[model samples]
Target: MTDIQLNMDGEPGWEPFDAPALVGASLRFVSGDRTGNRFRMRYFRNASGELVARVWFGPETEGPPGHAHGGSIAAVLDEVLGLAAWAAGYPIVVGNLNIHFRHLLPLQTVVQVDSEVVAAAGRKISVRGRIVLGDRIFAEADCLCITLPEEQRRQLG
Candidate 1:
């Protein structure tokens, strides 16, 4: 196993966050593999308190000759969008996810995921986000999150 230095620059005023501290080991699927060539992610909150991430799509995520698979992109979106609601103080689980692919993301490149909670009514929370490299968007997504029932939350922990 080798360490791959994350190739992301923190934006001014962005507050770095520890996702595991908020969501615990549940995030291991997407954010784990610290030394493997899979997905490497760093989380933060922008000045406006929106959830943001800098993710490196390692060579292991390749689907096409040199790009990431659609499923891989979706998986990251699911985790980030769901976590967005959690970071905003909603203990939730993703109920539905809708994604639109704009471009094939190149493997071994670092991109940004910008997400925000759009609405919350009762047990439902809506979040929208996108994967991008500068002005080029690789994918866009909307996630519907359902607040975990008290019993369900207890069971997960």
Candidate 2:
């Protein structure tokens, strides 16, 4: 394991991301799980204008000894990728999530999640993302999201 410094605050080339009012209030499953209490996510836009998140996997996310649980990693990917779609002007709900875990993420370390909107066709939006620590990749995901009906979206808000 390489020694990596964790910075909770915003770093250079990244700006803080404020979740839209409704999404911030309605998000409760993974991003706001009280029992899991596994992550602290700070959203940002990198210099190139891609969606990014800095996430800290806390102690409660442990699964394999000192590493973060697979579920935790998946949750982060789900939310960040969905948000990436939203940032790209799509109103969506994740229809399917496919994640590949490459390495065990150490607990209490801050990792970067970089996301991009890849495609859009009718109601479907495709987004790709990854969780990385310096040069190491912990996980990567491809998400398929379905745009919500305008009426249903209003109901969510």
Candidate 3:
């Protein structure tokens, strides 16, 4: 097993997210799975308050050759983009997720995911995000999220 070193202190213009606060709260499936060990994700918020995540694709996520699986990439996009909506103050669940893969991501590589809430109309929210390694974009995603009903939100809380 390879040792993964993470900078717990976030990158410039961003702040580390409190993952424990979200576990079992809104992101149970993704953030609460401690045993699968497919990825190590660190969340942050940019200076403009957009949600961002720095992710390390672990060996457990391998697919074609030494690259990360497409499904793993999509999972990251789903969680990051969904949390982006929540960070924007919309209690939401993903209604639709569309991802375009631009390049193959290598396993064990740390990548940056940047997300922003693009539009909001009533209960529907549109978010755009991308996974990148420096100047190269690995994938881009657009997500439509639906706000949970007040009753459901209260039940979750």
Best by TM-score: 1
- Residue pairs of candidate 1 with colliding backbone atoms: none
Candidate 2 accuracy as lDDT: 0.84
Q: Write the per-residue lDDT of candidate 2 for residues 40-96, one digit (tens) a residue.
A: 777788888888988888898899999999998998899899998888888899999
Question: lDDT of model 3 at residue 44?
Answer: 88
Residues 32-146 of candidate 1 have per-residue lDDT tens digits of: 7655789988899999999899899988899998999999999999999999999999999899999999999999888999998999999999999999998999999999999
In model 2, the worst 10-residue window by lDDT is 1-10
Model 1 spans with C-alpha error above 4 angstroms: 1-6
Q: What are the lDDT scores of the predictions, listed in order?
A: 0.91, 0.84, 0.84
Q: Model 2, which residues run further than 4 Å from truth?
A: 1-6, 20-22, 33-37
Weakest ten-residue segment in model 1 by summed lDDT: 1-10
**Stronger candidate by TM-score (1 vs 3):** 1
